[model samples]
Target chain A: MTPEDMDLLAALGRTRAGLKVEADKHYVVESRLAPLARREGYPSIEALVAALRAKREERLIWAVVEALTVNDTAFFRDRATFAFLRETALPELSRRRKDGSVRIWSAACSTGQEIYSLAIAADEARNLEPGVRFEFFASDLSERCLEKAQSGLYTQFEVQRGLPIRLLIKHFENHDETWAISPRIRQAVRWRRINLMSDLSGMGAFDLVMLRNVLPGLDLSVRARLIENLAARLTEDGLLVLGEAESLAGVTEALHPVAGRPGVFARDPAYRAAAA
Target chain B: MKTCLVVDDSRVIRKVARRALEDIGFDIAEAADGMEALAWCRAAMPDAVLLDWNMPVMNGLEFLQRLRQEPGGDAPVVVFCTVENKVENIRLALDHGADEYIMKPFDGEIIAAKFAEAGLL
Candidate 1:
């Protein structure tokens, strides 16, 4: 393949694996990435792709992946999902847990929105269970996103999207015009860099997993592989949520759709039966 | 003032719904889940219910199904509050006896108009 063709394929490969890019929109990708290429001392996208393909340095490959992962997320991207989580999911999960602690994992959490939203959800759930112990794990593939997630700072526009005025007052302090997530909520979540393609055993099991808005990027094989990986970390009766647009259709046999909630599925009892 | 029950798991959404309804002279009651909503409805019948689709213990669909079976003087109008903007979900909500369907992150004026459409205003 030619240098340009290789660049296109690499971009396509990464984008399909949930690292974000509008590969079809070449000019837009080029414009957004030009500065990174310049900073990395590469003259063109072809040169950058060549360097990335050579894989001489792991850090360079990561930089390309980081650039490709679209971190375009708001405080609460989809309001209803969080609503369901706070009112229904957490409370129910809390009741089912033999231990007072509820474990929630925000898989592929980008820039802290999903995890922060979970913190807010957990706080809402706490209203029902005052002494509820929460173990929140927020993981992503990009170290850059993890740093931002760790910082817990958001722009005014970012805060305005799904954050309520009351939550703003209660959980965030104004850092000049930028809103900073409270230390309590920030501390509630433990952020880490985790590639979904790798082993997730060390993270332990979770009662609830928010895997929303991240999956459609993979091919059918990778999608199924990722779901199988995720399913292992979920408790037997645990809930697995996906983005409103994403689905488990043909992805994995381990999960079956929950009756009422679209894009939300649970471990298949039949699979459990077979395993048992 | 007309009483409206806002059933959602998210505090932010509940606050937003309450504020929107209150601005149009409606008293608001809040429920975080289906069981709480059903209990609240049994005790005090609100003029309307703003129900969310995907809640934890009892989701909106299950709540609607239960609410329909109960014997009450007058059943409150139920308008589904959701982010599932798909037409099929809306149709499902309506089929399950939801009077109307409203998408979330909506403007206050639109909420007020929904109340008016429901004749609660």
Candidate 2:
């Protein structure tokens, strides 16, 4: 890319809204965005950025954003986190809910891997408690990602990553080269296009909200805002999970880290007791 | 009895592999990590080594590299037992003097076949 393209990407990165595709990542950006640039009658990244700057069309801006969004997801990404969710969090939620219905939201759930894994956990939880009800809400900022998540089809390699064979056989069926999640597991989740930067009140309260592997790219203000926004939607006794590398330090005063579980925090119940 | 060194970080995987290898008449010597495996190899030369790719310290690839640098490097047939089944990983292991590669959650029959291929059977 030319100096102009580099400058454009750097500017986007400063906004902390873009992933900041660096000089080394130019090839990746070029490959992902080239087709869209070609279809728009732009011959190069320079022309594409010019059009994007002129506010020529919302579609072109969206195309740029979509191209920049890193959607590197696989089935059961981070097995230990899922294991904790299965062995500890879900059971705790089940016990706390008098109605026996547990709701979970996977914010920034790119390509639905995390949500689908939650579906597997929910299925297992339901088997343990026959009367337990579960609902999973999976949301992503990018419409393109939401589309992939809704489709719920993955390559054999994708499905095999971190997915045990027993869960694979139980929740997926082979469809030629791809493995599609079973309808029952698919039905358990509700997918929506949601911007983490926007208000989350309409999504309703949730027992658990997974914001894993996303905070590092965000600016401190945006990260704090996102946490506060999510905290409002968290059930009084809900759990908030960040990326393993992400921390709540200076992000929110309402959350206290849960010992032994990285990136996991519980709402301050004393505040609730005082309010009550 | 044929002796096999099982090198893995997970206790569950070690147990499973031990049962399979022992049932096929191989005596099992287990190591929790790659460094321990190397030490065990130096002390007692096993007929075969079942090596895991990822470990806390001294990963399998590094261990294999070091092992190949040692005297009688090619004496014991080394089978890479790992969760990472990428072709590149397999190629790297073979290039670094591994005899074979097996994906995780493997069956006893596959282990037997690998042992037979290594002339351990």
Candidate 3:
């Protein structure tokens, strides 16, 4: 790919998806977009970029943006996070809520694994507090990924990653070569096609918002804005879960890290009082 | 050096499983069928057993039953690695003392993940 092609694709990614394609990561862009260009019937990457620059076609443009976005995820990705949710987060939320209803949002839920994992956590939480009920809301930028997530069908290889054997047997129906998650688990969540760069006020507040592994790929300004939007959508006592390696050090102080938890954050009381 | 006895009538499957199990730091042993697996267990109990559902002479379920009756047979973690995908088959294996069930066409990653879940890794 030419330098000009790289710049155009980078600009397209940033403007459309809030993704920041680093100058050094040109290979990542090329590797991901090469197949896309071929499938789109373009002779070369340069031809595809030229076509993109010529006119703004919504379908093709969004296709390029979605391809650039990283969608790597697995079931119960970090076991410790779910353990903390089961042992501490769910119990505490159950204690505080008098109506016995807790709402969760899986922001940037790629291929539905994370959301289903959250569903499993909620399903098992009945053992802790029988009165507590969880409502799930999940969203993604990619329509294709969302479709796969909606299907709840996973290949043998996909099911092997980070999924415990017991949960696999319990929650999924085994087919010849694929596993489909039970309808009870799939229907528990409300799915939407959302762009975090835009306004989020229409969506209701959540008790727990999981924006894991998303911020790292976004530009700096977009990350802060996304965090602010996420913070606004969280209830006063709601929690926000980020990726393990992610931090809010230079990001907005709308939320503060919950003590003793690496990735989990709580709505900052100070920020809330000031906003009030 | 935890030992795992891979029991399958098919030598190809046994070899594939041996390579995968060895890659994850397990001492490997191969058995032709359930009877040989039972004999191997009678002499020395392995840390785990990767058993196939169907085989000549003695099948996986039969071997599991007989192994459980042996003096120290209940020690090994028996994981049924077979083409059996039916829920009834899975329930049967679990009911007959199998610890976990993995469908066929598995790889090293699956073995590692399952072993880790079973606390053998």
* 1 or 2, greater by TM-score: 2
Q: What is the lDDT of residue A175 in candidate 3?
A: 77
Model 2 vs. true fold: TM: 0.66
| DockQ ranking, high to low | 3, 2, 1
**Which residues of candidate 3, in runs, are more than 4 Å off?**
A268-276
Tell me the tens digit of each residue's lDDT in model 2 across B11-32.
Answer: 9999999999989998999998
Task: Report residue A253 deviation for candidate 3 (angstroms).
Answer: 4.0
lDDT of 1 by residue, B84-112 (tens): 65545656777788876666657685576
Give lDDT tens digits, candidate 1, residues A1-276: 254644554565454344434435676566656777899999887787777767657677666666665566766556667777777777767766645888899888889988898888777665456556789999887787899899999865566556654465568776545778889899989878887877778878898898877775554456777888888888887878898667777677878877656677778554333222
Q: Taking the candidates one at a time, how many backbone clashes does each contain? A: 4, 0, 0
The DockQ values of the predictions, listed in order, are 0.03, 0.05, 0.46
Quote the positional error of residue A101 for candidate 3 in Å.
Answer: 1.9
Candidate 1 positional error at B92, Å: 42
The TM-score obtained for chain B by all candidates, in the order given, is 0.95, 0.95, 0.98
Cα-lDDT of candidate 1: 0.75
What is the C-alpha lDDT profile of model 3 across B1-89, one tens digit per residue? 89999999999999999999999999998999999999899889999999999999999999999999999888999989998877778
Interface RMSD, Å, model 3:
1.8
